[model samples]
Target: MYSTWPNLDTKTIHQQVLKWINERNNGLQSQN
Candidate 1:
């Protein structure tokens, strides 16, 4: 994937990882 403006992929990947972690945490919290 690519953005219209030039940018590093690390930032995008980091944001995605954060979102994934948040979703996982929510699911775990709901189960508890």
Candidate 2:
């Protein structure tokens, strides 16, 4: 899936993944 983004460098991709993980964690916390 990451491969689909043509111009994203490693640092950008890492940041995006971190942001996504944080969002998912927040969602899970809210549900609890």
Candidate 3:
């Protein structure tokens, strides 16, 4: 779970979430 702090903007938060998810998925894909 991610901690929501520092009152980040919606767009920034959305981008951050997307980037983290993509990185996680990419790692799995590369391992297979």
State which candidate has the highest lDDT. 2
Which candidate model has the greater TM-score, 2 or 3? Answer: 2
Candidate 3 clashing pairs, residues 3+ apart or interchain: none
Error of 3 at 19 (Å): 0.2
Q: By lDDT, highest first, what's the ranking?
A: 2, 3, 1
Model 2 Cα shift for residue 30 (angstroms):
0.0
User: What tens digits encode model 3's per-residue C-alpha lDDT throughout 1-32?
Assistant: 33565577777888988999999999999999
User: Please, what is the whole-model Cα lDDT of each candidate in the order they appear?
Assistant: 0.81, 0.92, 0.84
Candidate 3 TM-score versus the reference: 0.69
Q: Assess the local accuracy of residue 26 in candidate 1 as a C-alpha lDDT between 0 and 100.
A: 100
Candidate 2 wrong stretches, greater than 4 Å: 1-3
Which residue pairs collide, candidate 1? none
Order of quality (TM-score): 2, 1, 3
Best by TM-score: 2
lDDT of 2 by residue, 1-32 (tens): 76888799778999989999999999999999
Model 2: what TM-score? 0.80
Give the local distance difference test score of model 2: 0.92
